[model samples]
Target: MVTGKAIVLSVLVTLSVVVRTASQLPIPPRYDGFVYKNRISADSVLVEAFFDPLCPDSRDSWWPLKEALRYYKHNITFIVHPFALPYHNNAFIASRSLHVANKINTSYTFPLLERFFRYQQNFYNKPTLQTSPATITQQIIHFALEKTGNSSFEKFVLGFQDKSSDMTTRISFKYGCSRAVTGTPYFFVNGIPLNIEETLDFAKWKSIIDPLLAEQAQAYT
Candidate 1:
């Protein structure tokens, strides 16, 4: 999240108009074993969020994000783009884990991701405590098993370890680099960057988002 006076500056930059609609944009490249959500057809505002699982700031933004989601709900569709910052080794694993969950089904992915975010603060405080990828995978598996009550958790966990997940991780890196996104939690609303300073005072951000969502709502009517 952009903060302090920088928030204003960032929001100003974000509001810079990029003259392209969702239909004009190319289909994002699909990496092997990866599932991409075609958000343009969803009848909601498209929000693409670039995040790192281990980043404290990313975790910090969760409450506000949830509030925003609730405030918009069906009026917005959020697509999470994984940006695994390498310094936090576990972050990449978390991203790949989401890809693995996505492979099985879209419904499972969001719940599991919410679970992961719930534990993010604990995970961040004890980076060394994560042990191995297998350990992390098991933790996620247990969470899924309990939440979904699925009997196939063991098979799913094993599948989650596949090397093919690397492709989506690479795609994330490339997308970030191309967009000049050097930080975690970068966001785009309707493919337009927000201009924090110019367009997003704390009060203004919600005002801007609400009207765009209203426009999307009207488009459907």
Candidate 2:
């Protein structure tokens, strides 16, 4: 009986140590900031998202919101920010790559975003996988080639890295840190927090978005 008790204690100690170590690791950056897209109006009810490409919840939240965009194009402006947490091995590189893509071809953003989510494990850090920035860039470039059928992906990728990559990363990280935003798929519609896990309802979206757009429209009129 005493020997069994000792074994149990040892197991508990091991778990405790593991838990502590995991806890000490940096949490992935919280989704934060305002990213406006295809501005149709001066005050198009702005929607901002803090997202992680590898996060399942981010993937879940993305489609519905993206679908809603088509219907609300003239009435709303949507912006994205990358609040990638440091603990996530490839998140920073992924986020930086996103900004690069944005500058090269704005059209590439959503398609690439969807691809990463659909193939999350493709980018997840593995013990044996090369996780350097160059490798990550190649992965993105390959995806772009397949998706866009653009042979110029090489030029676009390099241009993004050279011009706006670092700036975009800095802005995303700073915005997230300042807002204390910490989650995979957090959003604000007209500066109001969106409960993505709960409603995410298209009709529910209209309820909030319509009013903001109307208010802005009235102000302009």
Candidate 3:
């Protein structure tokens, strides 16, 4: 019998080939404000993540990841790429919505992602089995508008339909593929992929980050 993980992996591999056949897309932009803020020094550790918006693992990882990003704010640079897995029914639309949020306002990116994580259950395959794509898109837009008050509804709707926004989302997915990301909540630290199989926690994050930060503090002193 095919295991659940095997089935998911099979679909992911097949999807990767399909994406490779399509036009190559850019590496999704990283949050660059950290550089301008003088937050990143030569010693700063870079943490990059690829997440599926409707993925349960991604949602579970968000809290611990956010904590590390916050507590080590000055010592690390964090970038996230939204990768929509083929297995999740609305993952593409939700990921596309993130690009639209960024287009509307860069600051809206993580907030919208966080909101997606919170409301992810509603968009799961079973729950949304009967839901239309248009309805799903509207729900995502509505959720986005709720957290970020006063954002233009028209712009959000239009952005959703724009080719560029959708391309960017697919680009993000393809970007993750280039990195050989096979599953949700994949992570790399300082360009090295973390082969973690267990749940990530504060202690585990510090285990990787603190030593690097310590060396940085020592080197600068």
Candidate 4:
């Protein structure tokens, strides 16, 4: 026979355990954006990276990120979200091009991104005058034409130059904003924000990510 106070205390303790367990559970991957599904395990941790092609910080982080992805390719699923920063003159066009290219051919996504980052500085005009959006779009179209030699892709790019493309770009930007992303090269692991500093260090990233994978493995076992 327990007193009412003891019964209430027991209920609270049980609820706390339930809450903690739920908080530790892995979050399902988002529907939007590219998802590199893991071949090893469906329970692999999810990594969401928000990047701006024109951002120097994002460019700096790209190599380390690729290394980590290559090393942990079996243990994690990666997704990329383009967040165009307002300060860059051609950031919007760069991001929109990537999005549209992905739609046209998923294979084109990474090569185009690499090209943008490789020649990022060339895309910007003098500090006194910004490049026009139309010019930037044409540059991207030219890149696609040269890479694929697909006249259909050129037609698609020209046709996509409207409010719809603007809306799509805004939607992608807002998705990052809603997640409290204030800058490029931001990352989330298992639905939690990962420190940018840690992201730069491959060893630190492995330490942080390995445990998550192990935990997921234990859950399956």
lDDT of each: 0.65, 0.70, 0.82, 0.75
Report the CA-based lDDT of candidate 1 relative to the real structure: 0.65
Worst 10 residues of 1 by lDDT: 31-40
Please, what are the lDDT tens digits per residue for candidate 4 over residues 104-216? 76777777787888878877656316656676677777875555557547555654665655666777787888789999899998899986553376776788788887887
TM-score of each: 0.67, 0.70, 0.82, 0.76
lDDT measured at residue 187 in model 2 versus the true structure, 0 to 100: 80
Where model 2 places Cα greater than 4 Å from the true spot, the runs are 1-37, 126-133, 160-164, 195-199, 213-221
Which is the better candidate, 3 or 4, if ranked by lDDT?
3
Residue clash pairs of candidate 3? none
lDDT of 1 by residue, 5-93 (tens): 99887767666543333223233456322222333345677777677766766666655766776676666677777788877767777
Give the lowest summed-lDDT range of ten residues in model 4: 23-32
Q: Number of clashing residue pairs in every model?
A: 15, 5, 0, 0
TM-score for model 2? 0.70
Candidate 3 Cα outliers beyond 4 Å, as residue runs: 1-42
Clashing pairs in 2: 28-85, 29-84, 29-85, 35-79, 36-79
The list of candidate 4 runs beyond 4 A from truth reads 1-30, 36-41, 125-130, 150-153
